[model samples]
Target: MNTVLTLMLVAPLLSAALAFAVRRHDQLRDALTLAGLGTAAGASGVMFATVAADGPFVLRVGGWHPELGIVLVADRFAALVLPVALAIIFVVELFAIGQRKTAWGSNPELSGPMMGVLTAGVSLAMLTGDLFTLFVAFELILVSSYVLLTHQGQAAQLRAGMTYVVMNLLASTLFLFGLAYVYAATGTVNLALLTERIPELPDGVRLGIGAWFFVVFGTKAAVFPLFSWLPDSYPTAPTTITAVFAGLLTKIGIYAMIRFHTLMGMDQLGNTMLIIAGVTMIVGALGALAQSHVKRILSFHIISQIGYMLMGLGLFTAAGTAGAILFLVHHMPVKTVLFLVGGLIENDQGTGRLDRTGGLARRRPLIAALFAVPALSLAGLPPFSGFVAKFAVISAGIEARATPWVVLALVAGALTLLSMTKIWLGVFWGADPDRVSVRRPPGNRPMMLAATGIAVAGTLTISALAGPLFDLSVDAAEDLRDPEIYRTAVLR
Candidate 1:
């Protein structure tokens, strides 16, 4: 089990090194990239299964003991998110293989190799059991994303990368300073140790530290006031890059918030989180309503949908937290596929502006069908994962007597459907961009469609398997609510 976890981390970095080493051979580089991501995804599945069957598996690097060594713990939450993260990277990597001409660059190896580094970073963020390791993993993700965002060498891309780079650096600084304060006050940075020590601190001290956690993670999660960086940045990158970032990156911040909320005993701050969650959803959805471009609309929805996840956390009950976890897992692939479908639209007509793209329904019925699944799913339509996930959150909110927030969520869901309707009508039915209908080109069309297929199928499968997944989420939520379980697993 330890070997599986370690391999999940090392395989990607090793493949990244190999990618650059054999950059001259495109076929070899592609093979290495695919194998690397596949290996990580496989290991993630094993880790999840092992944890489910035998409890968490932990490893201490350098034989330095838990306090001073590298601690990696694969508990239930880590098990769940890591596989999703790796699976996403795998799908995007495979899709990029057929899209190398413009989607990648003159050398596709550069972009694909960076993905390897990113997989390691995301895996580490999920698996590492300490603050410093988490910070380092975040830095790894940031570095790779900078390259990916600007891979096209376009001025717009560089500008977008610059914005992300500057803002993320500040976030990282805040995180470091916060970690320093946490360590200085508690004398240890290990998550398990902090879990034991945080609850023993004075109220004022705890409030101060918890506030820092909120701001630091709020920026990453794209929570309301702190989400200004997402909308513009996502649209400026390549579509696949945008899709990958949309799916996997922001969720890390949400994951951190989930991790520490219980460890730090965040009950005192529950009301404040609820307010933030409300504003985040409304603002994000309304922002989407105002957008003309498909990517920008989807980008705004990202912030809006995050509000739903935060709602779960703010309620902070077993059911509430479980609902939030389910929302997170459901949104990841659904959102990514939506963005990919948008990319396909942009590919067909050379624009994502709804006003510019019309009659796709008649021109490409299959593409429209593909878009409809995740679109309706994202809008909380029935029988899709979104509907089930939202039902959980709303039910939990009502149970907690959070009537106001639940009302706001209902309004936001309506607005979300409106936005989706606008896209459907404008892009698919409004007008045909060409004088005559045209089928999508052969190049990269199949690959892009296949990516969307995976996302849709996975989402529907989750919906079909909602009972088991909700059970898993309940277990994860319980583990989170009782940090003692996690602390004992790691410290023992």
Candidate 2:
């Protein structure tokens, strides 16, 4: 368990250093990058399996106690989410390999190493037993993303990157304040300690802390009113970078929010979160409908779909938390796959603008098929993982009798379907543009397609295994709702 945990945290950073040392060798750099990501991903799978069979486990870095030093816990929640998150990064790395040297690919020299840093940070963020390390993990992710977004140094990218950085910087500042407040009030930043100490504070301070961190995490999750930067920032990155951001970054914020809020027993904030979740869902879906670019549309949907997960958390029930967990797992890959398909469209048509492309169904039936699966799933169509997740969430909401929030969720679902239909009609079904000319780097199609096909298969696997997956989600949620489970596992 300790070895697996070490590899899970160290492999990516180690590989990143090696890749940077040998940046001149393209194949070697890519191989090192994949090796690091693959190792961490494999470790995540092992961790997940181990935790499933044996329950939660913890690694005390440097043999220090949880109260005095770093701790990494592989509870059911962290273990369950880690594999899917790391796997998405691995597959995106493969796609990046194929997409390199193209107009759409990130800078080949830097993307690999930066992704290594990003992967390590993701592992740290998810596994950390304390809040301060989560902050450090966020910095790792944001710093790498900042470089990734602006490395190309195009005017649009710089502009978008600035907005992205500024917004996140504000969130980081608030995060620091929140951390200080937490430590000042609770006497320690260790989450397990906080779990016991936070709720003992006066009601006012406790609620204030909960609300403060919600805003901080909400911004990262791109929840409504804090989401304007996302649609602007994400579309400007290379498709591979965008896919990683789309799949993991904001979700990490949501992951943190779920962990922190629940463990601290902040049920007083549930009604407020539900209100925000409703507005976030409708606003995001409506925003998606208003976009003409594929990436931008998807970007809005990211915010919209986050609303569902937030809604689940807001319900503050075992069932609702389970639904939220399922939604998180389903959204990560499905969202990543959608962006990849967008990349394919951009590669083929030389643009993601709906106005600049059409008739992909006739010209490239495979791309159409690739886009259709995740698209329908995104729209919550039946027999897809999205449907299963949405149903769990909505069913939980109904049981909780949060009728207004439920109605907004359904409205958002309808808008999401409409947005997907708009993309299909504009990009795949209309007559081919008069001067349609395909643009792609030679010999890249097979690898890109294969990578995408693998992701699609993964999504199908999620759908097929939805039953068992939901069972695990519920078990994870049970642990989350009952904070003693986490505290015991970490402090033991």
Candidate 3:
């Protein structure tokens, strides 16, 4: 009777409905959104502790037979991930509570109700025990994101939304086909049951399904050859929306890939992700170097960072999975902090265009410091969360003797450093003849301050808690390496 997991899943949904009904009241909507997210955070934390203490918890919807019903799982990995996603969503929502003024009132771009559904969908995607249920969650997120993407009513945004919609629709279709394949082959859609049945299938069928899973998740993950949609779509959204998307969505896709590979006999696909990892990293880093806008640079870096996580998953060892988990945890905070700070810069400076900006360091040390900390961390500087993440990944790659991918990852890291340096020098380091400082409204500054402060603090806390956090990730990876643990928990 894991009440925490159940509440964590359902609260945001109820809150979403309530928030939408009262859309005319800005303060009420904000309060409802914050309250819902706060409750979800508390619930997810309790679930994490419960998972560690009591093992995996499963709830079968409607109390039907496992094969006939939907299921939600609160496993070691889900326990760890749900809170991270929720935290970012909360911070981004706080940021939006001010900047977003909809026709309704406060949520011009991302209404409180939409954010609630988005967070709920993320949690559901993490917790669902079957592909069909995950598909439903995906639909929820897709609908929420599309509305927000077109919020600005810009031609560029509309264009970006089309690409995003087309690609994800294709991915969703692939997910349905993949789900059908599993049901046809195994007679059950339950992940636990599939875990039990998959090993008996022919090797060719397994490989074909593996390929399909990659195409489906790779598009979602924004891995290369299917990656163009992300840089276009993400940068066009409102800053808060873009920050949330950068921090959570693609990580969910990577999470799906890692889970599928480890649990469902798609370890054969590890090498495929390995090749894609190196290419995605190099290409993305190069793209970051080419960008002048702060948002676009960060957008490209998302692709580059994903490659590092893929490297971890590709190695297919506990050490590798551990690296992936830690890197994922590390990247979420860093990415959110970067985007919040970037948006703050644009809000005050009249643009996020680096070429038009200068002299922030001398003029606004706080904003400068915010950017500098995560910037160095993003480049994998030591004593930061990013260092912990990158080292874990590179060490695992070296141990596996994946020399080519290792070299490419190192090169990507160097390029990440170079790109950050470019932004620093362009936007903050050099002298501005105008000597422009952050001149944002004092009222609006609270939102920027709150969002960036909380994000960077979380990033620092990751470093402070690295040993314990890394151990938790190791425990989660242990479960991934041995799916029998997951299977037994639900089936029994």
Top-lDDT structure, candidate number: 2
Instruction: Supply candidate 2's per-residue lDDT for 72.
Output: 92
Which sequence of candidate numbers ranks them by TM-score, best first? 2, 1, 3
lDDT of each: 0.87, 0.94, 0.85
Candidate 2 matches the true fold with a TM-score of: 0.99
lDDT of 1 by residue, 1-492 (tens): 878988999999999999879977988998998899899999999888989999878888776777888899888888877888788888877667766664322237588899899999999998998989999999999899888888778887777778888888999999999998998899999988888888899988888999898998889899989998899799987777888899988999999898888666788888899999999999999999999999999999999999999999999888999999999889998998898888778777778888778999998898899899889989999989999899999999999999999999999999999999999998999767754322334356687678778877887888898888889988988888888898888888
lDDT of 3 by residue, 135-186 (tens): 8988888888888777657898899999999999999999999999988988
Tell me the tens digit of each residue's lDDT in model 2 across 231-296: 999999999999999999999999999999988888999999999999999999999999999999
**Worst-scoring 10-residue span by lDDT in model 3:** 101-110
Q: Model 3: how far is 246 from its true place, Å?
A: 0.2
Q: Determine which window of 10 residues in candidate 2 has minimal summed lDDT.
A: 434-443
**lDDT ranking of the models:** 2, 1, 3
Model 3 residue runs over 4 Å out of place are: 101-106, 433-443
Prediction 3 global C-alpha lDDT: 0.85
